[model samples]
Target: MKEIRQQKKQPEVIRKRILEQATILVSQKGISGVSIQNIATAVGITKGGVFHHFPNKKNLIEEMFNQIILDLDQTVEYLIKRDQTEYGKFTRAYIHSSFIHQIDGVVSAWSALSMTMITEPTFNKIWMEWLKNRLSQHAETDSHPDLELLRLAADGLWLQSITGVIDDEQCSKLEDDLLNRTYLT
Candidate 1:
């Protein structure tokens, strides 16, 4: 029984390693630049071993996106758990979370890789759904343009950071100033 438990962990560990390596590769090279062999080589696994975890590159990309969505959900949950009763607090929390991800050792890779994935049609549905859900949650009686704008601003900041147009420190200050001006009383 113990051996079985330990064996089960091996596959999970390998899968996670593959995903992490994939993220790094995807960030360094665009999604179009990654291949199964590249991911396998990075993870120190055989190409067949990579296929054992993901049947194809497309499958691997989809799984990568799924993992990103899970990370995003965690971020949203963290934001919701904070002081969010104010009208614009949710929006501010969201921008704050974006900065957190950029600086978070565990999540920074995802944030970086996500900028690449964001342009892919395969990942569009996942992101659109998330955006719609969040907007709905904070929509009040009518749609809130201010809240949506904050969300867009956060996305812009993340993209700028990922693309090296701005560093995290600059992005943080910009986000802070945006939040300070935009947060409703």
Candidate 2:
């Protein structure tokens, strides 16, 4: 019985360690470049140990994407609590927070996954479904027609910032304009 209990706990411990190391590697090297051995070394474990938790690289990438989804959900909830209006909440949370920089690692992971999915239809469907679900929440049926456009614009700005195409001052101005167009009018 004790052996079984220990076995059950082992997976959780291994998974936690993998996630921690994976997050760091993804952040520093981006997803395409991160290797199982790199993660294992970072966590002081063997490659087989990392594989024990996640059977393959794709599984690890998917888990990282799931974490990003969860993080976004939590941030949305936080925004909802602060602002009663959906548009207000979304705009404020998206524009003001450093989500672009904060989620860069996850974004990089997704980018890599996206490239692979181009040839694999199954993965593409799942990825789109996940994205639609996340967007749909903020785009509840009652939301204004412009809500989708606003969301797209915010996403573009975020992408730009992450790619180093936009400066801090530019982001600030863009945020102001987005707020004005979205709510101030």
Candidate 3:
């Protein structure tokens, strides 16, 4: 029974490795520069193995996008729970997750994957749906104009950080400014 469980777990391990390697590759080369062959080579698996898990490159990308959204949602939820004030809990969480949060001491995958996914029409729909859902869920606490502006400013910082246009000091200051604004009446 233990051996059977190990055998079942092995495939899952490979699948996760493929996703990790794919994210690393995307961070380095952008989506257009990476392919199934590249991912398979990085993961030490065959093309067929990747197909066995993800069917096609688009499928893999979609999975990656879904994972990023899930991670962001979890982070926002955690931050919201930790916040003492209700005025801008959601917007504050959004700004904090976008700006200060890191995964495993590196920038979150959202910074890299988003730049590529943002250009895809389907991916845009996915992102919009996520934003709409989160906004509606937090309508009571985060509906103020200042909070909206803060969220938008956070988005600008997100773009700048991903593009390397903003230095760390500037980004931190802007992030703090945005977070503080979220509390305005």
TM-score per prediction, in order, is 0.81, 0.67, 0.86
Model 2: per-residue Cα lDDT at residue 23:
62
Q: How accurate is candidate 1 locally (lDDT)?
A: 0.72
Model 2 error, position 67 (Å)? 1.5
- Tens-place lDDT per residue, model 3, 1-185, is 35454434588889887877777666657677779999999788899999999989988877877877887899899999999999999999999998754545565576645755644656788888999999999999998887888888888898897788998888888888888888779
Any runs in candidate 1 off by more than 4 Å, and if so which?
Answer: 1-9, 102-119, 141-143
What local lDDT does model 3 show for residue 144?
84
* Candidate 3 overall lDDT versus native: 0.81
Candidate 3: C-alpha RMSD to true structure equals 3.6
Sequence-dependent TM-score of model 1: 0.81
Candidate 3's TM-score reads: 0.86
lDDT (Cα, tens digit) per residue for candidate 2, span 1-185: 35454434567767876876676566556567789999888777899988888889879867865665466557656766787555555555544443443533444433333334543345567667865765566654325656557656876776686569999789878867775666642
